[model samples]
Target: MGLGCKMISLEPPILCRLPPTTPTSFRTKTIVFSSYAPDKGGGAVSTGLPKAHTYTASFKTLGACKLGISWYPDFEYNAQGGTGAGTGSKVADDANELSVDFDIETLYIPPLTSSTTKFLGLPLPTFLKIDIVPQLFQGNINQESGKVDLEFLAKFCFSVGSVYKAPALLVKTVLTSDESKGKIRGGRGERLDEEGNCKLVGVAFVEPIHDFFMDSFLT
Candidate 1:
């Protein structure tokens, strides 16, 4: 028996419909980004505020008086209000001035002992000892200029082995990159340099204590 075969056309319909075209204005849009992109020159683009940085330093000071006493202070800058971990903000009016905080507990000063301290090329007596404990350290620094001005507050404890112990002498001063003048002492400081070295100077007045020993010693 012979079978009949049917032919089918694959051409599209003559009335085929096309989707409507979008308006010229609607086809393009302007997008705004909170951050800017780098320029064609390939320069860096600032996204927002600058970030906080931590710094460590060892500060040393030598007296110009007769005793020739010296101090070695080691400290670390937290840059986070001294509360441990976090980023710090900048001053409201100055973007270059960054608020800094320091870890007071980390502040250390070598005791005036025979091994660590000397006086006029002579080793200090073992019986006499002096220690410094930082109470407060907070200030602002110009990141771009490397200028620093920090308010430093510390206590100087004096003791003579088992013989006597003096009350802590409160010392407060503004350690700065500029000059600091007190009633009896004054000095100048230097700004931070490319090697991260800077000199901070401050003069603090030693007030008389009510105790007889302190008054006599200070006088």
Candidate 2:
């Protein structure tokens, strides 16, 4: 480990193949929104804000396997009067800085098939993510008003499933890299592209559960 760098690890990865003709279990969605404002922030003495921020994170079980996707979307908020000087008291001060952060993660506990064995071999997971939205609030408010209310939305699509098991003895020939979009389909293949870029294969999520969190974060 370097003086400021943290270590990250993972495991073998399996590929999700699109059906030859039509892909099953596909979902599509879209979101629409609007906002009307007339000086969102009241006087400098008011505690309530005409502007607000919100967050969300979630995962839906596809078919009862032990894996799911993880995602975090940027939030929405009412812009405070800070860009250009306005008529009022300028509204914000050094201590008036307000930044909000939100995160959501969905984990899994390996499930088994109906066979006498203790694991399942049919359940496979994958991921798909695309968020091309950047900070669009800068142009929303007029420089004359100095007050702004901003609205933004984000979306993602990904899947999570296990690859292989260690059989309680073998050191498990682990393979990990970051070629999801083109991360081939096989049991063990960890190679570099023509230019060289490491892929992210599998990962072990054993830091701790609800009970073990205190030792890692609350200590």
Each prediction's Cα RMSD?
31.6, 19.3
Q: What are the TM-scores, per candidate, against the unseen true structure?
A: 0.60, 0.18
Q: Count the backbone clashes (under 3 Å) in each candidate.
A: 0, 12
Show where candidate 1 strays beyond 4 Å. 1-87
> lDDT by residue for model 2 over 102-204, one digit each (tens)?
1212122112222211123422222211111112111121123211111211111121234222211101111222222212122121222222211222211
Which parts of model 2 have CA positions greater than 4 angstroms off? 1-52, 64-110, 115-219
For model 1, residues 1-219, the per-residue Cα lDDT tens digits are 000000000000000000111000000000111123325476765668543333332222222111111121111111111111112345777867666665666543334456544555666688987665668756766767866666667676888899999888776666566665534344455565544344555555556667797656454
State the number of backbone clashes in model 2.
Answer: 12
| True lDDT of residue 71, candidate 1 | 29
List lDDT for all candidates, in order. 0.41, 0.18
